[model samples]
Target chain A: MDWPTFIQSISNAVILGSIYATVAVGLALAFGVMQMANFAHGEFFMAGAYVVYVFYAIGGMPFPAAVLSAFPIVAALGIVTERFIFRPTRGNVLAGFMATAGVAFVLQVIVGQVWGVGLMRSVPTPYMGAAEILGAKVSWQRLLILPATVTMVGGLWFFLHKVRLGKGLRACAQDVEAASLQGININKMTALSMAISGGFAGIAGALMAPINAVTPYMGHSIIVTAFIVVIVGGMASIEGSILAAFILGFIHTFVTTIFDAVLATMVGVAFMAVILVVKPSGLLGRARV
Target chain B: MKYLAALAGLAGFILLPHFIGEYYVEIMILFMINLILASSFRLITTVGDWSLSHIVFMGVGAYTTALLAKYLGWPFWGTVLIGGMASAAVGLAVVFPLLRTKGFGFFIGSFALGEFIRLIWVKFHFPFGGPRGMIGIPSIELGDIDFYEATPYYYLVFIFTVLCQVVLYRIDLSRTGRVLKAIYADEDLSKCIGINVARYRAMAFSVSAFFAGIAGVLLAHRLGAIDPKNFDVNTMVYLVIWVVVGGVGTFWGPIIGVAIMMVIGEAARPLAEWRPLLFGGILIVFLTLLPGGLENLILRFKEMLEKLRSAGESQPAE
Candidate 1:
C-alpha cells in the first residue's frame, strides 16, 4: 500500500476501534458485574443511532445534544431490561441472556413498525469537513469519534475506580455472596452496570449514525462482531474489550482495504477462535478460582 | 394403554395428511422436520451445553445435499445419509474448540464458529451460491413414486421423523443418555466419577447435529432449493425458543413446544410483521415464568392426578 493509503487505513482503523470500544465496553461491564450476557446489546447500539436520527435529524436538535440524549434514553432501556428480564431469571445466566434475544426481536419489530423499514434512514452528516493528517484525508465526523470514545471510556474508568457505587459493582462482580454480605445492594449494582452498558452502546451508535446506514436489522451484523470482541477481550474485562476492539478494528479495516468485508469478518472470527483455545480467560481477564 | 395412544397418534399422522389441504400438508411436513430438529436439539441440551450453531449444522447437511445432488446426481437416500455424516463431522469440529468453554462462552463461541461456516457460503458463489442461496435442487423420486406431491412427501417426512424420534428416545433411556444428564446435573461430580465429560458432551452434540442435518436435507429436497440464510442465527433462536418453550427435560418436551408454537405461528399469520413481537413476548414469558416449558406443566398435572388417585385408594381402604 502507498503511504497515503496506509495512513488512511490507520486513521480508519482508529475510528473503527473507537466505535467498537464504545459498544463492547458496555457489554463487558454488564457481563463482568453479573453473568448477564446480553444478546440484545447490538439493539441497544441501534437504539442509540435512532435516537440521533430522531433528535438531531428529525427534531432539529444540535448533533452533540442528540448524541448526548441517546445515553440516558437507552440507559433507561438497560435498567428496564435488568429490572424485568434479567432480575426474574437471575440465577441462571444463560436463561437471562437468551431472554434478551426475545428483547431483540421485540425491539426490531417495534422499530420496523414505527419507522419505515424499507429504505435505510440516512442521517445527514453533521460535521462535513475532512481533517488531513500525514497526507491522509479523514472526515471530521469520523475523527470526532476518537475523542468521544476516549472521553467516554476514560469517564468509565474514572467512575469504576473512584466512585463508591462503581466499587460496589466491582465487588459484586468479584463475589456476589461476599459483596451482598458486605452491605452492598446487588440489585442496585446490576441495574447500574446495565445502565452504563446501555449508555456506552447508545453513544457508540449515535456517533456512527451518519457514518453508516441506520436500520433495525443493522444490529444483526454488529452484534456478531461485538460478541467476537467481547469473547476475545475476555468476557467481562473492559480493558480487554478495548484492546481487542482496536485489534479487531485494525484487522477489519486493513482486510477490508485489501480484500473485502466478508474476508475481514472471517479473519476476525478466526482470531477469536484461536484466542478461545489459547486463553479462555481473555487477554486481561483473571481466571476464576 | 400408552401403546394405544402411540398407535392412535401414528394413525392420525398417516390419515390426517390425506384429509388436510395441500398447504396444511406441507406445513405438517415442515412441522415433522422441526419435531426432529427440536428433539435432537434436546439431546445436546441434556449434556448442559446450548449451541447457537445447531441450525448451521443443519445448513451443513443442506448444502451438502444440494452440492451432492447438483453435481454427483446422488439420489435422496445417498444424500440424506451423507448430509447427516457431513453435519456430524462439522459439529464435532465446532465442539472441539468449544469443549473448554462453558455456559455463555460456549454459546458465543458456537455462534462465532457457526457464522464463520455460514459466511463461507455467502462469500463463495462457486458451489454454495452466495447470498441468494442455491436453487432448483432436484426433488426425491423412487422409480414410479415421485415424492413431489404433499401426501407422499408428508409420509416420507413422517417415516423419518418417527424413526429419528424412536432412536433418540432409546438414547435418552440408555446409559449414555443417563451419563449426559449426569454431566448436566453436576459436571465436577460427573468428572470425579469415571464419566468422560468432554467425550460425552461432544458425542451428544454431533449426534444431535446429525439428526438436524437430516431434517435440513428433508426440508431442502421438499423445497427443491437451499440457502445460507435459512440456517442463520434467527432460525437457531427460533429453535432455542421452541426447546425453551417446550421444556427440554423430557424427550417429548421440545416436540410439544414446536407443535404449539407452529400452530400459534400459523394462527398469527395475520399479524404479518408483528409476528416476531408475539414470539419475542412468548420467549421472555416462557423463560421467566415457565422455564420448565409446556412439558413441565404436563408433568405437574400428571403428578396431581396420581396424588388424587392414591389418596382415593387409601381413603377407601380406611
Candidate 2:
C-alpha cells in the first residue's frame, strides 16, 4: 500500500495490540494461578469503561482520576467474583467458567438497567486533536494507549519478578499444593490474581471508553478476541498473552484495513487455530491447558 | 405402567396440536426441535465434553438445507439428508484440531473453530448470504399435505424428532454408548483398556453434530428464514443452560431440562428482556446448589418414595 496509509496502519496496529495486551494479561494471570477461567472477562472490560463513564463524565472528575477509579472498582468486582463464584467452584474448571456466563448476564442487566439500554452512552473525547507522525496523524486519545500499555505490562512484569506476593502467585501457579505447603495462602494468591486481571481489563476499557460506543452489549465482541488471545498466548502465561496480543492486534488491525472488519476477525481466528495446532503450550506457556 | 404413560404421552403429542392455537403449536414445534438439540448435546457430554460449537453445527445443517432447497429445487427428503452429512463433515473438521486438547482447552478450541465457520458465513455473501443469511426457503411438500401448515409441519418435525431420539437412545444404551460413558468416567483407564480415546471423542462429537443438523433442518423449513444471529454465542449459552439445568447423566435429562426451561421461557414472555438475567441466575444457582440438576431431583424423589414404601411394609410386618 501507500506510505501514509501503511504508517497509519502500523500505528493503529500498535495501539490495538497494546489494548489487547492489557485486557488479555489479566485473563492469563488468573488462569495460570487458579486454572479458573472467567467467561465474562469481556464484562470485566465493560465494567472498566462504565467506571470511567460514572466517575469522569457523570461525576465531573478529571480523566486520569476516572481512569484510575476503574481499576479499584473493577478490581473489587473481580475479587468478589473469585470469592463467591471461583472459590466455591474450584477444581471444576468447566463449572466455574460456565458459571461466569451467569456473571456476564447479571453484569449486563445491571449496567443496562441503570443506564437505560435503549441508547448508547457517548463519552466525549477528552484529548482533542492528533499527533502527527511520519505524515500520518494519530489522535492523542489513541496515542495514549501505547505508553499506558507498556507501563502497565512492565509494571506487572516487575511485580511478578520483584514483589514477594507476585512471586508467591507464580509459585502458586507452578504448583498450588507445593506453594501452599511452603506457607503461601492459596486463597489470597487467587484473589490477588483476579483483582489484577479485573483491574487491567477495566483499564483497557476505561482507555477506550471515548473511542468505542459504550453500550451494555459491547463486551460481546471483545470477549471473543480476549479468549483467542489467551488461547494463543497459552492459557495461563502472561508473557504469551502479551506476545499473542500484539500478534493478534497487528493481524486484526492490518487485515481490517486491507479487507474488512468481519474478514479481519475471521483471519484472526484462523491465526489462533494455527497457533493452537503449532504450539499447543503457547509461545511462552509452560502449562499444557 | 411406564409403557402406558409412554402411549398416553404419544397420544397427547399427536392430538395436542389440534387443540392449541397456531402460535402455541409453532412454539411446540420449536420446543421439540430444541429437545433434539439438547439431547444430542448431552451425547457429547456423555463423553465429558462441553463444546461451545454445538449450535454452530446446527447452523451448518440449517444453511445446507436452505441452500439445497432454494437453489437446486431439491426435495425435502434429499436436502435434509445432505444437511446432516454436511454438518457431520464440518463437525469432523472442528473436532480434528481439538483432539489434542481436553477440558478447558478443548472447550475454547471448539468455540474458536465454531466462530471461524460462522465468520465464513458472515464474511462471504456467495451461498451463505452473509449476516442476513438465507430467506424464502421452500417448505417440505409431500403430495397434497403441505408442510407450510402448522399441523402438518408439526408432524414432520415430530417424525424426525422421534427418529433422531430413537437413534440417540439406542446409541446411549449400546456397547458404544457404554464405552463412551466409560471414557467420561475415567479417560486414562479407558485408554489403558485399549479404547481409542481420540477416536471415540471425535466420533461422539460428530454424531452429536449430526442430530443437531436434523434439528437445524426442521428450524430452517419452519422459519423460512435464517441468519447468523440465529446461531450465535448467546444461543449457545441458552443451550448450555438447558443441558446444565436438566442434568446430563441420563438421556431423559435434557428432555426434561428443555421442557422446564421452555415453559419458563414462554411464561416469562412478558419480561422478555429480563429473561436472560433470570436464566443466568438460574444457571449459577443450579450449578452451585443443585449440581445434579432437575433429573437428580426426580431421582431423589423416586428413592424417597421407594424408601417410604419399604418402611410401610416393614411396619405392617412388625
Candidate 3:
C-alpha cells in the first residue's frame, strides 16, 4: 500500500477505535456501577441514531442541534429502563438479563415499525470536505469523531476522578450498601450511570450515523462487537476497554484492508477466542467477579 | 400417577401422526426439535451457568451432519450421530476453560466462542457452504421407505426427543443432578463439601451440547437445509427465553415453555412484523410477573386447587 493509503488506514483505525471506545466505555460504566450487563446498551446506541435521523435528516434540524438533542433523549430512555425494568429485577441476575433482552427486542421492533425493516436510512454528512494529515486525506466527519471521543473520555475521567457524585458512583460500584451508609443514594447513582452511559452511546451513534447504515438491526452487529470488546477488555475496566478497542480496531481495519471484511470479522473473533483461552478474565480484567 | 401421566403423554405422542394434518404435524415436529434444544439449555442451567451458545452446538451438529450427508454420501442416521458426537467433543474441549469462568462472564465467553465458530462457518465455503447454506441433504431411509414427509420425520424426532428428555430427566434426578443443584445453590459450599464443581459443570455442558446436537441434526433434516443464519444469536436468544419462561430449575419447564412459546409464535404469524413486538411484550410480562415461570405458576395453581378440595371435604362435618 502507498504511504497515503497507510496513513489513511491508520486514521480509519483510530476513528473506528474511538467509536468502539465510546460505546464500550458506556457499557463498562454501567457494568462497573450497577453490576448489570445492560443488554440493551446497543439499543441505546440505535436510539441515538434514530434521534439524529429524525431531527437532522427528516425534521431539518441543524446537525449540531440534532446531535446534541440525542444525548438527553436517549439518556432519558436509559433512566426509564433502569428505574422500571432493571430496578424491579434487582438481586436476580437472570431476571435482569431476561428483562434487558426483552427491552432490546422491544426497541428493535419499535424502531422497525417506525423506520421499516431492512431499509437503511441515509444521513447526509453535516460537515463536508477532507483534511490532509501526514499526506493522508481524511474526511472531516471521520476526523471529528476522534476528538469528540477523546473529549468524552477525558470529560468522563474528570467526572469520575474530580466530582463528588462521581466518587459516590464509584463507591456504589464497589459496595452498594457501604455507599448507602455513606449517604450516597444507591438508586441515584445507578440512575446517573445509566443516563451517562446511554448518553455516551447515543453520541457515538449520532456521530456514526452519516457513515453507517441506520437500521433497527444495525445494533445487532454493533452490540455483538461491543460485547466482544468489553469481554476481551474486562467487563468493568474502562481503560481496558479503551485499549482493547484500539487493538481490535487496528486488527479489524488492517485485516479488512489486507483481505476482506468477512475475513476481518473472522480474524477478530478468532483473536477473542485465543485471548479467552489464555486469559478468561480478559487483558486487564480483575480476577474478582 | 406420574407413570400414568408419562404413559399418556407417550401414547399421545406416538399416535399424533394419525390425527394431525400435515401442516400441524410439521409444526409439532418443529416443536419437538425446539423442546430438545430448550431442555438441553435447561440442563446446562442446572449447573448454575446458562449457555447462550447452546444453539451453536446445534449448528455444529447440523453442519456436521449436513456436510457429511451432502458431500461424503454418508447415511443420515450415521451422520446425525457423528454430528452429535462432534458437538459433544467440542464441548469437552472448551468446557474446562469455560467452566472456569462464573455467571455472566461464562455466558459472554461461550457466546463469543459460538460467534467464532459461526465466523469460521461463514468464511470457509468449500466445506460448510458458507453463507449460501447447504442444500439437498438426503432424508433418512428406513428399508424401502423414505421418511421425508412430516409424519415419519415427526415420529423420528418424537422418539429422539423422548429419549433425550428421559436421559436428561434421569440425570437431573440422579446423584449427579443433586451435585449440580448443589453447585447451583452454592458453588463454594459444594466445593468445600468435596464436589468437583468444574468436573460436574463440564459434564453438564457436554450432555447439554449432546442433546443440542441431536436437536440441530433433526432441525437440519426438518428444514431440508442448513444455513448460518439458522443458528445465529437470535436463535440462541429464543432458546434462552424458552428455558427461562418454562422454568429453568424444573425438569419439565423447557417442555412446557417451548410448547407454549412456539405455539404462540406460530399463532402470531398473522401479525407479521408485529410478531416480534408481541413476543417481546409477552416475554417481558412473563419475566416481571412470573419470574418462576409457567411451570411454577401451574404448580401454585395445582396446590391451590388441592387446598380448595381439602377444605370442601373438611366442611362436610361443619
Model 2: reference contacts kept, as a fraction: 0.56
Expressed as tens digits, the lDDT of each residue in A1-289 for candidate 3 is: 8788898899989989999999999888888887767888888999999999999999999998998898999999889888977787777655776678888899999999988878699999988999999998889988999889999999999999899999898888788888999999889998999899999999999998988899997878788778778878987888989999999899888999988888888777767766677787678987533
lDDT tens readout by residue for model 3, B1-318: 999998998899899889878999998888888888888888888888878788999999999888887788898779878888999998887677776677877787788778778877888888888888888888888786668877888888888988888888898899999999999999899999899988899999998898889888888877878888988988787877777678875888988899888888888899888877776777777777788789999999999999999999999989
In angstroms, give how far residue B151 of model 1 lies from its true place: 1.4
Comparison by DockQ, 1 against 2, better one = 2
Runs in model 2 deviating more than 4 A are: B305-318
Off by over 4 Å in 1: B308-318
Q: Which docking class does model 3 fall in? A: medium
Report chain A TM-scores, every model: 0.98, 0.98, 0.95
- TM-score winner between 1 and 3, please give it: 1
Q: Tens digit of lDDT per residue, candidate 2, span B235-276?
A: 999999999999998999999999999999999989867878
Candidate 3 DockQ score? Answer: 0.58
Give lDDT tens digits, candidate 1, residues A1-289.
8899999999999989889999999999999998888989999999999999999999999999999999999999999999989999998888998999999999999999998788999999999999999999999999999999999999999988999988898999889999999999999999999999999989989999999999998888888889889888888899999999999999999999999998999999888888887898888888620
For model 2, residues A1-289, the per-residue Cα lDDT tens digits are: 8999999999999999999999999999999999989988899999999988888888889999999989999999999989988998999999999899999998999899888798989998999999999999999999999999999999999999999999999999999999999999999999999999999999999999999999999888999999899888899988889999999988998889889999999887887787777787888887677
The top-ranked prediction according to DockQ is 2
Better of 2 and 3 by DockQ: 2
Looking at model 3 chain A, which ten-residue stretch has the lowest summed lDDT?
A: A280-289
Worst 10-residue stretch by lDDT in candidate 2 chain B? B283-292
Q: Rank the candidates by TM-score, best first.
A: 1, 2, 3
| lDDT, candidate 1, B1-318, per-residue tens | 999999999999889976879999999999999999999999989999988999998899889999999888999999999999999999999999899988877887888899899999999999888988999899898998879888988889999999999999999999999999999999999999989999999999999999999998998999888888898899889999999999998988998999999999999999999999999999999998988999999999999999999999999788
Against the true structure, candidate 1 reaches a TM-score of: 0.98
